[model samples]
Target: MTLKFLVLSSLALLTNAHMAAFHKAMYCFNGTASGQVNYNNDDPVSPLWMLKKSDYWFHHVNQCDDFPPAPGDFLELPAGSSFTVEVAANRGVTSLSFNGQFATDWGDGGNHPNDYSVANLAGAPLSSSGCIGNPNMHTQNQSMAAGTAFAISYQSDISQVTMDNLAVFTVRYNTPWKRVTSYDVPKDMPACPADGCTCAWVWIPNGCGEPNIYMQGFKCMVTGATSTTPIATPKPPVWCEEDQSTCTQGAKQILIWNQAEGNNIAVSGFDLSGNPKSPAYNSKCGFQDGEGFHALVAIGNVVSDTSPQEHRMTSLVHRPLPPQRLQQLLHHPHLLPPRPHQLLDRLHQLWRHRLLHHPHHLLHHLLHHLLHHT
Candidate 1:
């Protein structure tokens, strides 16, 4: 049996009405690590893929019969780099091609090739699905050498005649990120020690082997020592900063302010003079380079409501620490109250422990709490 034979057989089983009912197959790539690779997920048209400075997936979408690019034009990867294929169809994926070689032995009628269904396509795994087997359970390309480019293609059954909701994604960690240390808050803001205030510091990892952002000094609770509610600003539209300020170029400076729903912090960019550029408006304040910052922002008292709300600038940093490492650190016998000499260091450790352990849910909960109360 040949690939053409299986395709024809699969087509024969479907009725004309079924063919016309469904007309699109979505293709995409999954499993790329954060910031390792870049693709335009926003642009449905003219999607681009780049590994470091090199181009990978770039093509035009046309009719299914003549849409995919040539094999030589397919994306290339260095040795040890891999990507997976995701296929979704209104009807079903009926034909697949690799390097211009068609697979024939996909069971009968090519129904569910290699036990892959539409669900699998939507749930694309982080790794490659491996090549399809022929009669001997072997692919046409037995070996993949380093620094090679290859093409992959799939065709939907007659019902799938249109292309929509189709996309491709690729992940490559060819280059590592640069480590960034603490970002200074707006200058006039009080440091750690202040009247009627308790302070804590937290450092989130940026995967570049450095603290992405150093958040120091959170406003301490004034009363209710036994409560567990989070403190928030008096109301939205309140500026977390007493005055809007900018830092010199290369100075990691951030401005955090309160809004009706939640607080937003903007990481300022540098002008040619290396001075931080201020935003025309507070809401518009953000990283000028267009890179996002990721860190855990903790404001107010984690202990109770009615406490003075202290704002922390964090978020959008890439590559965080592992959960297991955080869990182990929590169980250490040395984790204890901070001494007068080590209060600052202890505060930093506490922030790290809380953020790493509850990165996702905690952020969501805090955001929700702030939004609803406002």
Candidate 2:
């Protein structure tokens, strides 16, 4: 038995382990707002041609050299998964580039007091050539612990009029990113969920327009994989020992009223009042149950259509014995064994649900006022 457990544990670990990943879409020339680039090539129509990317500079000459910069200016990607970033090749995109060095201010050309590696030249653009032959300038590792940060300089080479075929994909991990553990987010794809788990449709275009251009660097990736939190149906507050403390004893009672005519599902309504009455039943009103000179409120508690059959009989025709401020309890957790109350609870539950969820019900105000006055 121990051996079996060990094997299963190993398998689970193997399945959970994952690599770094990114989602890539068409690289528009120039930033979208600046009109520096456009999407060309794929069905949505992303196109690529002989246009080598300019030097890696944003805003000012030495602007992006600073640390803790904005997202569009730089990136710090993990290497757990095999990341193969290729730039659209019109002519000069040769390889990925980058280094760990960064600057917060674009010092003018030649202004370093230390003068360690230079005499002058402050705003000189850094290159991602830590190694060479790559333009996205990158680092490779298995994990990216929290708080780890890196800086890299990169650019796309527009040296030649290369083909326009869209980039390709290769798996780097053993388990699937979306299905196995985390949810997969595609760069060029948008997904719409519907009908509470009944069904989902994925919009995927099998092809891109420019079959030759390659995209550079990290893609706007999806963060977490938690889809939706499951909610279990709440059970009715039964007449259990735990609830005895909350209920009033001896001739005191709570009145729950059911209004839904059928099992049919509709919208919702507003009815916070269930039992409204004497001060004893409601401490705020100076009412005490069974002991003091307290009276019960007129409760409008919603009972469902599928209430337990045993409770229905008591609910429809419950008669209490007269007590001298002593022991005639009305609404107790202990359900009457012989009452026919099935279909009552579910009906009430549905009505309340509709009232809250579909609050724009045309007859909400009308129905609420009518029921309240009655």
Candidate 3:
């Protein structure tokens, strides 16, 4: 019994040593891990190490696009809803089920036996004291973890998609941390083309590991969309971690860091807080949820289906009242808009102004409101 135990322990150590530390999107359409046997085979879905501005930068040499899903096998993104994706060190740990077919299960490859445990699921393994020990996962301090984002291109054909049109509609902070993660879709996102939209999940870890990034493609379609206002052109994100006023205002593109070519933003030094600056997917990187809606409204790109109340609010922001008229309304509350909903609309107008001009103040007010209301 003693000899057998020693042999098993030796084998486990050897296996772990041979395994590479990397992760990929498992459930993404045409994911490379469809039928992979080695749960730790990070080759097919390997991270882009010091990538250049070539085809490889786009969905890893376009291999992910090679295995297109069958008709109707798309990653569904319901408008005003959220979708979950399974991310793992390898596909073997996942169900390997896609397009109404089940692939071979080569076991969990002993890489993540504790992943499903209650403690692990609840993030017990992640420590706020520092980065998680596993280089494959994200840091425990969510604010410190490099963020991840989901960008969508209106083009249904993956080949037709380009960086300029791939607008990032949503961002997830402290991501690549768990096997199962969820991302919120914008309520006002426009519907995709008939063949469905081409989406990509991109990520870049803050630190405590390699400087590589991840980009996986997916065939997705949005349902229940009531808006036809197309997404605005995406510009490269800038490092506005210090002064949010400098942050990009409209739709933003994904970050391409540490690459030889096509690197949009660079943070080679520390930030105002004296921490290493890393462009992420959160507010620091100019990616605020629902910013698309606000941008469109601010630019007078209001959709036709917007509610009457919303239209009134948009008009109020664009068409400011004279000082005397404003003072008259302010002094005589009775002269203001009637109905409780109109009052709420006025408050929303104020909120929108605060959000665009004084976001920090708006955040403080939001926290205060949540504390008192909830």
Candidate 4:
């Protein structure tokens, strides 16, 4: 009995150490003030997935979908308005308000037992400017924290929602920093279908620790929509930190990084300044308010394609090279001929045709030709 008790205590400690999630999310329907407040129970839904792939990495294994709420219990997204949610390391801390009181105390032996601050888990000031006190939460740099986004899929059924159709409408930069966080709803957003829409809160940290992502689902409905135009299809975001002009335009899909499968963007290198070109849910990564093809055209980048093949080809040729490749070429500019634009176009064509099997080999071949022939 003593040995078993020790093991269970250790497990509980481990779970409490790295726990953080939105307290009022649909998955926490079982949480209440008078009863068991932590709806996730002892399972602990906020553990990092590291580099390994698991169903828990995204939407916490769809536990929220399984626990469907009754009508009118859905999260309301008022178009052109904002909504707030309490984020904490444990649901119990958020539940402290049920008794008409707030959890303001900090440190190890606080009123809310076994709970840590969602923003500053150490319960003290951070010594450094980057990555904050706890490496797990990655809330160190207030101006550079990986932003969080809210995406809406018109499907009322959670299972029917996928990355392709779930379009990010608004992004809150430098978020997951405070216990109470607010997210804006796009003014031009349209109403969902009759049954309502499936929404998700997605986040990818800006490289303070292990590269893990977060996605939590919510049954949400637009309460005050003024537009009838549907959200356009979402495209995978690109690493365009060096050049905002080259960023992918229109609605963007939620980032899926460090996963074995279902990864939409693959960035394995640093930028020109030696900084990891991590794709985030902010304006630097092409996500903007009222994003759509029509919005792009209104901004004067008119996209006219006669055929589907033409459209694909146009997007490919115009797409900027991957950050790693761009960094390499920019660092070694002397190897290029007098007119580098022609060579760049050729490289884009080669990339379009999938002729470059290995990126390093392609760079080597190009450099060799430029050195010997040019």
Candidate 5:
């Protein structure tokens, strides 16, 4: 049997409405490795999709009609409507997105968790100065192959909509966000890391490869996307989940595929619209002239609540390393102790026991150098 859907714009336009949903199909995706699972939950106005680990690397979620940042994803409601948003996390939160941009809020001092942003968009003290945040993207036609649409995954907290004969679009959300009076970036302005966006540490640790991150990052770069394009910031703001910080120009994004490395971290699409992102992170927000469309194994990091909280300028630089290689660093003989002449004793033992290991193991040398030099 075929499924059908019905929509009522006012249903979503209202901050709190008593109206009922028209009728939307329910989609579900469940699968194992070497396959995909992108299921849509029941919701006409804003549907939900469940993506398994395998789906993370591919654009499986886009098949759902509710996916945002895509044209026609939003149905403008008649003026003077109200609605409410709700998000609940069961498993580890993965990502959030709003209107195809990384979810963000001008409500928080214009920054992210670092600042306290008021949730009250209705009471920002209306002034002729106009809205504070007006986000825009500088991506050109040459960067992402041409017309690739990037995901605005970020942390999102559900929001309630309230409008007065005017259509208002919310670009971001926060869960533990405290209410505040004014934010610097303004509600419409998109916020992002000024320069350099790589997720080498976050992605690699989680077993992500360079192929996907480079492809997706550049997809947004070339598109000139905003943090949360007033339509696609994923709600309930959770780590790895779509938020409004990255995806915007000069922004950074690091996707962790459910913590099981190798499950994700690869790009499934080769078309990449037109101008693919150039390999490695570019200093400029977007592609440079002549760079054309490109992709890479680049890595980057952005400031979150943890790790390098004080150093906004600090970023993670990472390269793929095998677990065994890392283990070697953890277990070096020279690191046992420094008895000055202990090396002689170790050598004697090595030869006497017929367990003659080399005195010049790379790991031993590295540890020996660190132990003595430090």
Candidate 6:
């Protein structure tokens, strides 16, 4: 039993050691130049390793060279993921052309950098020479060596990658100065999100034609898998033609109204034809849910119907009628035919007053006045 236990323990140790060696941890560039050119650090250097990168830059110049983990270093990229790298350091005006090195050597190679895609590495591990042959890799020439920022980017035709793997890259200043960053790119793409998660047509408040209102960078690029869900644009309220047939003599006012699909719709009325036959009355009003909407429009004092057969009467309904106008209306009642309901209501109101208390006397006087005039 002891012999069996020893054999199992040996197998387990061998397996762990083999797995550790399987990654074959890669090395960063060691600056060996004399007098302030060398960076002293052990393998897998601190703070500056790349894990997952959506977009990244290494700002070594301008005192931005502090060691910090790369932002977005841990990423679960969908298929067809891509990235760009930028260098802002001055490497001098020499015309020598050199490619930024990105390497596939997890740990096996010297200070050489790797530019190969994680997909390619998963398919077949890249040699140092293979890393150099990448088509989308960036090359630095004398023109770009003057400390101006320059960038290079690459995309992989290969769709997928295996997880738990490392991608390493480095840029050289003088003497192949290597402070490289490494990333752990993800294998599987994230699941597509639930629907209705995005704004289909973002309602820009009054954003129709004004150039001042515009979409932010994030909103502009968004597109749904299906055509963007269409939003029901709020419709403007509309005014319908008012009924003119109901206009009659002695009617003090009429109501004007409009219909709208939206809650905020407002309504107004205008006198399009100023002709006396049609007359003019303007109105303004708003709407609410249960209370209903209406606008009061004062009837015109003077009425001239388009047809000659209709009786013509003028009303002074906008304000209190002048004494002279009232006298004229009272003496010539034929001009303003009294509506039965309005006249009866007026009589009832007058009966309540002390001045014309007796309905019998009022009726007798009105009859004599009408008959004598006729």
Cα-based lDDT for every prediction? 0.23, 0.21, 0.58, 0.58, 0.22, 0.21
Per-residue CA lDDT of model 5 for 57-127, tens digit only, reads 32223432223222222211111222122121100011121221211232111222332112333332211
lDDT by residue for model 1 over 1-374, one digit each (tens)? 98656644553432211101011122221112233211211111121112211121121121222222222222221212232221111122213322213222221123332334323323322112232221111111212100101111121221221112111111111101111111222211111112222222211111111112211111221221232222222111112222323221111222222112212243345533353432211112212221111111122122222223211211111224365643553444233222221222333453566743555644453444445444
Ranking by TM-score: 3, 4, 5, 1, 6, 2
Q: How many backbone clashes does candidate 4 have?
A: 1
Model 5 clash number: 78
Count of backbone collisions in candidate 6: 17
Of 2 and 5, the candidate ranking higher by lDDT: 5
Candidate 3 TM-score, true structure as reference: 0.65
**Candidate 1: misplaced stretches above 4 Å?**
1-56, 60-374
The numbered model that scores best in TM-score is: 3
Give lDDT for model 5. 0.22
Clashing pairs in 4: 132-140
- In model 6, the runs with Cα more than 4 Å from the true position are 1-312, 322-355, 361-374
Task: Give per-model TM-scores.
Answer: 0.17, 0.14, 0.65, 0.63, 0.20, 0.15
Residues 1-374 of candidate 6 have per-residue lDDT tens digits of: 67445433432322101000001111111211222321211211111112122111121221121232223221222222222221111111011101222222222122233432423333333323232111111112112111111011111111121111101111112111122222111121122232101100001111011111000000001112222211111122222225433322221111111111112233333423331111111111111111100111113322222233322322322234455554554455454334333334333433444335466756854665456545
Model 4 CA deviation exceeding 4 Å by range: 1-25, 31-64, 95-102, 105-130, 134-136, 289-374
lDDT minimum window of 10 residues, candidate 5: 198-207
